[model samples]
Target: MKPGKVKFPATKKGYDAATIKDVLPEGAAPFRRRLNQEVDITCIEEGFYGIICTPHDDMGMVMVVRSGDDHFPG
Candidate 1:
């Protein structure tokens, strides 16, 4: 859950946000090591899809998808 204003989706409060990237405070690099990952999904229905992450995390190999074959351009 993020510590700030702005209504989040999912939970009633702001406890329904995804942690996309992890940008720690400056000079705090010794706390945790950085890693990369991705998520795959198949869209059964159409609505809203979201990709959330912490600040400062690099954008590589990360994917939040809506499952469906119709979404593809063939």
Candidate 2:
């Protein structure tokens, strides 16, 4: 996909606190959870991106984003 910003909206309780691993693209924005606010990230590279909620990461609150084409063999 083309370079752009991805937005993650926070919930009412504001438990969406997120942070990106160092493997993400160079320009990826640091994520933070704020009540009723949205977090925007700009990924400039084509690869796998990992995101996790600091407060809930241990509970498996995490996600992976894949940019560009999928290279898995069918």
Candidate 3:
């Protein structure tokens, strides 16, 4: 793999990342990897701020939108 390219799973799934153990049942191993990977992926995604698990999108994935909200309250 290249220095920048991460060799994630080559499955049909969009993003292949590792899930953390203990949080999920032993049977649901395929979907679960590590929460850290989600964080990394989320950071790369757009319209992202925070997330709340809902419906089929339980991971709480968010799309970060580049709005004019960068102003800090001084």
Candidate 4:
């Protein structure tokens, strides 16, 4: 997902911090997603990204995304 290429639409809930340290790739900036609004994300780095809704994080409102091809060693 290139920078500003991917769009995240918040139809039901919004995200407070989209990129958490250690979980997202380096240089990935944390962004917010307002309710009923859309936001763009930068996933140019090849790594795992963790997205969470600050207010609903305790309720298990979280997601994980992998930006690159799976190249696990055999």
Candidate 5:
């Protein structure tokens, strides 16, 4: 993933809200990495089905992918 691929929220509260409520498959550990002053998240799952997100509505990024054909916009 590129730096532009994942852009986290400006505040901790927004970042928390973006990830805390997400429910990934079993054995999938929470992923968090600090990039400079911002902490971005790569919450998308591998395989045919997964999710993609955009930064808006205080949700940071919110996207869903559920097929091999599914596309993630840049």
Candidate 6:
């Protein structure tokens, strides 16, 4: 793979990112990933931040978004 090209697996059921983003209601924030197949997003704090699981095994995943309001997912 190159620096930005994505190679989707043969088992994926969806491909349209815009359609997925549209599924969320207005004012809702979304975190999109192109290469991630099996992701686990979790709220690090009660309602402050969330983590996006990385493909790397040794490297730790970090918070990709932080929110104090209802815009972000719980």
Please report the candidate that would top TM-score against the real structure.
Answer: 4
Best lDDT goes to which candidate?
4
Candidate 4 vs 5: which has more lDDT: 4
Candidate 5 overall Cα lDDT vs. reference?
Answer: 0.38
Instruction: Assess each prediction's global lDDT (C-alpha) against the native.
Output: 0.30, 0.66, 0.30, 0.67, 0.38, 0.35
Clashes of 6: 0
**TM agreement with the true structure for every prediction:** 0.24, 0.65, 0.18, 0.67, 0.29, 0.26
Q: For model 3, where is the 10-residue window of minimal lDDT?
A: 42-51
Model 3 misplaced stretches (Cα beyond 4 Å): 1-16, 30-74
Native-structure RMSD, model 5: 7.9
Which regions of candidate 6 are displaced past 4 Å? 1-32, 36-46, 69-74
Point out where model 4 deviates above 4 Å: 1-4, 13-17, 70-74
lDDT of 4 at 43: 74
Predicted candidate 4 versus true structure: per-residue lDDT over 1-74, tens digit per residue:
44434577766654454555567667666566665677777677776677877778789978877777734337
Q: 14-68 in candidate 2: lDDT tens per residue?
A: 3665557584645655556564567777666766677776667679988877766
Per-residue C-alpha lDDT of model 6 across residues 6-28, encoded as one tens digit per residue:
22232553321211333333454
Model 5 TM-score? 0.29
The digit string of per-residue lDDT tens for model 3 on 1-74 reads 11121233334435434433333222322233333233322222122132222222556553222222233236
Residues 1-74, model 1: lDDT tens digits: 21222223332222223423332222211121123422222323432233343332254423343323324334
